[model samples]
Target: MSGFLEGARCSECMDWGEKRNTIASIAAGILFFTGWWIIIDAAVIYPNMEEFNHSYHACGVIATIAFLMINAVSNGQVRGDSYSEGCLGQTGARIWLFIGFMLAFGSLIASMWILFGGYVAKEKPIVYPGIAVFFQNAFIFFGGLVFKFGRTEDLWQ
Candidate 1:
């Protein structure tokens, strides 16, 4: 945190940080959209999906909300600059970011639950729709984390 945030080092970091950040953002977007594509493909391909687990969709919804929350908070706010540097001037932003992470993790767990409990337990078809939902949430969770931490100076090293 010392040298990483220093002015001299930061100038060098800034030279490449923006490019790394953009690449990370693009990766996240690709993963997120790929997940949605899988889900949508399932819905369109298997129009007659019987006994569909509604909770699978719920996982995606929760992950989507978490993603939005994670993106809503500024990076400075997440680093507690709100309290120390009076940037955001409040601690609530940190709390919101924590809640967002929790939601993202919960969505992942819920997706696994659906995969095992609803699909695996019942011995569902080979191409189960639940798999798509699980993949969607998992991708979103990983992608969001990557996007969140990708800009950090430590990661560049």
Candidate 2:
């Protein structure tokens, strides 16, 4: 009896540990939203939160790819079976799901920060964090697109 759908588990590859993907994805999600908040924080959200520093959106691109790949790995697992390209679709689905979640949660966090205690990092801009965040999102975006568009494996094949 099948229990429940867990996560993406590719066959052939004995070592089945998408932990890195998970970490990367989570990091991407956090940055994507946080970065956005920072970029737009200065809007009406706060009387005085708008300030443009250096551009680090390039990093966002990387994070996006990471986020998408994370979804692909976790959602397109094929344990005790062959690798199927269909799994790619599963990964894409997972990515979208995360997107929905991020939209909802991101908004909530930004709103809370705007209303209650304004989030930090606004006072000063850090090049490192911005760069890191940009890359995380960038990776997720590319990874997901590739997975969705290119499904070479059957996951369990």
Candidate 3:
């Protein structure tokens, strides 16, 4: 009975590990897709420039760029284990990661600023566009985090 239980528990652990990777990937993808979808919906609903300023899209664009930058460097490369040939090497990876994070944070903050300053503070307070912008940046930032740190790097190797 003891041996059987042990075997079953081990198998369960393995299954869970495999499932975790899939779950993380799916969650990240959903978040990213939903973020974009919301922004697109907002744009469609408020096509006029007066209703929804097109310039606000720049925040989402910057956030997307940050997401790409954050995921471009693998865990091994950042840790100096699997990458060392480049001129800057691990340090470069670290710097790049730092810059990515900074951009992500900056984008999120800017979205909040737009929400408050552009919409909430206005006399009429038309809020759908501002809310959409804020949520888009928030979802993208969180999705990037999930994609970066939620999965086990060892499993991929």
Ranking under TM-score, best-scoring first? 3, 1, 2
Q: On residues 1-157, what C-alpha lDDT tens digit does candidate 2 reach at each position?
A: 1332222233323333334344444555554566456544433233332332323333343344444444444333433232454544655555656664464344334333433232244544423333333334443444444343333343423
| lDDT, candidates in the order shown | 0.77, 0.41, 0.93
46-94 per-residue lDDT for model 1 (tens digits): 6663746444677898998998988777676667543354444447777
Residue 30, candidate 3: how far off, in angstroms?
Answer: 0.4
- As for candidate 3, its clashing pairs are none
Looking at model 1, report the run of 10 residues with the lowest lDDT sum: 81-90
User: Which number leads on TM-score?
Assistant: 3
Give Cα distance to truth, residue 26, candidate 2, Å: 12
Estimated TM-score for each candidate = 0.77, 0.27, 0.92
lDDT (Cα) of model 1 = 0.77
TM-score of 1: 0.77
lDDT digits (tens) for residues 31-127 of candidate 3: 9889999999999999988878999999999999999999989888888888354567888999999999999999999999999989888844468
Write down the TM-score for model 2: 0.27
**How many Å off is the CA of 29 in candidate 1?**
0.8
Q: Judge candidate 2 at residue 135 and give its lDDT.
A: 35
Predicted structure 3, TM vs. truth: 0.92
